[model samples]
Target chain A: MGIYRSNRWLVRHVDVKVLRGQLVYIIGANGAGKTTTAKALLGLIPTDEGEIRRGPALKVGYVPQRLHINPTLPLTMRRLLRLTERYKNTEIDHAITAVGLQRLGNPFVSTLSGGEFQRLLLAQAMLSRPDLLLLDEPAQGVDAAGADKLHNIIDRIRIELGCGVLCISHDLQLAMDTGDDFLVLIPHEHDEMDST
Target chain B: MTLFDDFLIRSLIAGIGVALIAGPMGCFVVWRRLAYFGETIAHSALLGITVAVVFSFNFMLGVLISSIAVVVVMYYIDRSENLPTETLLGLLAHGGLAIGLVVLSFFPNMRMDLEALLFGDILAVSKTDLVVIWIGGGVVFASLLFLWRQLLTSTVSEDLAKVAGMRPDLTNLCFGLLMAIVIAGAVKIVGILLIVALLIIPAATARKFAISPEIMAALAGLIGVVGVIGGLGSSLYWDTPAGPSMVVTLMILFALSRVLKISYGTTEKSATRNK
Candidate 1:
């Protein structure tokens, strides 16, 4: 399946099957349909003409480009940890401390700094312990220090949760270091489609 | 208290319930910049009222049904359309209002109390309405609580929310349902035209002082209560329509927030000078 451009496809025909329990990183240049590919997989944006299939009772835990947590919203990091209502007591504390946000658990997510928010999102994603985790540009807004911290958390989560993860990021070196597999989108294809 | 006094107390209690739900939900509306989206649901209440009259059903049922349908329609359209949300809202809002008016005209025997539907009839509210509002409002509030994290995730970043294995589409549908139920219940007290003002104005005003969603929701609820009560009380004292009075009170509070913001800015400057 592919994402449409004016004439050519943004994402070319890619046939990659992820085995259960594998960590995958989708690496590509800017304007690549990396985000589109993730949306297709989640069934948010429709596939042009392909039957996308997934296991039964497939639940997705997604963090959008922005979490849109209003400053007025009474969201504490601790309260957010129990979103799925299935996590054990210690698990909540573990997830918070894992992201180095144990201290900020009671503070509202909206009050978090850029790095803090990213870590908070990571912590919440890990809380559910899902079968598959999808992340889009997880380090976009994070600083150098925070990005390094995020990479470590990513590695630990894969080992700790034993769940398959597909992350879309422009950080190619980081993806290579942590990602077990890769998918790249071709940006030139969209530009070429407009000319044609 | 007399029978009238009891109705007044119950109405106030129901208002408290509405404030609680609307406060949190409106926080999303203002932050996500979905003020018109809230208005769309409010406008559609007219159609719901018209349908209720046509079918002889409880008016609230008609409002609930129409509100739900409008929200579902909005969810899909928003997902598919590349157009700005405001553009889509303008189309649906005018269309919904026109259709409601036309539909109301068809029932010649019906004394379409346009004013009541436009503003609302707080005095006419019944005991059953309170029960419906509380039960339905309670469920909506709990569901929102359950989805709080995922909702924030999706609200902040849809891609991230999906990666986390929480579907934004499903979360949005749930949010839409919440908005629908809110519009339905609030239309009885605030009316179709002014309902959105109650939902959004208080939340927007609350945002000026709030630092997080949790505090924002609570403050919005407080603002809503203040707006409703102040408006209701003034209407009783001055012999004005309750609906407009409540909306006016909200507007005054909103204005006061702006003034406070200006004063605070000046205070900061003066403190800097002194320092």
Candidate 2:
């Protein structure tokens, strides 16, 4: 897939595939189109070139890097979970417990700490039972210990759901350790088509 | 004597009908920060009036069409251009108002009172005006209720709404149309200049005490109703203009609400902090 702006390529010649039950990480430097590639794969943005064919009956769940909900928006965690799909109380409880956020008593989303918010987002993604989970900077704003715990949770979730996991992150050392396969995006000055 | 025969009675009914609709819609306006958008549509009602008079068309219909036109133009400009929404709205608001005034100046033979068009003359509301206000307000209210969930979700986060399969753009377009309907229906009762004040003040006042979106909307409607009653009563006693008096009444209520909230010592900021 390729993305261009004003006849200049922002991202080009990207070919990556995620398989079931596998963990793949897309690693890149800043402004190297890591998030752009993930968005394109999720069909959030159109690709200017090449074709992206998805498996039949594919269900993809996406957890964005950071969700900046308006402070005035009166959304509780329970209400937010209901926004994407209608889940029963038991299912919601299970998902919240799965994310290790069982202590929160339907707190307002604006009141959540950054790590807690990320866990809530992950719980939201888990609700769909998706065939593939796309996470962008999933450990962002998390402490080192919390990041490790989140990665462990991601591993367990992948194993339990048997779903493919594609994550975008700048933490190369962590990505190298966690990913089964890695796609590294290198920025080039010119708009040349190349892939590794 | 028939109730409709009394001009004051007619004005009260019309004003209350408008408040019922504006209150809830105003909540969305406040949440989305669309005050300027409302002002733009309200200001353009003058252009609609001028066009109706010049072409011998129905004034309300003219207003609806012109307001929708502004919505359409603003939508396209927002999508295609890089201009800030505030700049675009400022240009359109003053431009439409100025053009309407200039056009009206050309027709010295027109019988309509420009002052009434600008500041409103609610005491002169006819039975037909009541019908339009109530019916239009009903439709707007029903539409808002129907789209309430999706609208609230979209207001919270457009990206999340999209992921949830709700189309934010479509919701926004519908909202713009609803605003047009309200502005057109209200132009005769509150005038173009003061319509936004009615839409914004009560909702802002409600925000101080509301714990949820539904409560905020309900409180806004209640406050608006009280403002209408108080303003109309004071206007009858003092022999003052109805529209501006209503706005002043709303402002006073808003001030009172703030004072009461502060004194009661349960401010939202403190409550959130405690949480």
Candidate topping lDDT: 2
lDDT against true structure, model 1:
0.76
Cα RMSD of predicted structure 1 = 6.3
lDDT of 1 at A90: 86
Residue A119 in model 1: lDDT: 77
The residue-by-residue lDDT of candidate 1 on A2-70, one tens digit each, is 667565576756544554567687878877788788888877777765567777775555554555565
Q: Model 2: runs farther than 4 Å from truth?
A: A193-196, B263-275
Which is the leading candidate under TM-score? Answer: 2
Per-residue C-alpha lDDT of model 1 across residues B46-135, encoded as one tens digit per residue: 888899988888888889998898888888898789998888888788788899999888778888788899888886778888888899
Q: What TM-score, computed on C-alpha atoms, does each candidate reach?
A: 0.74, 0.91
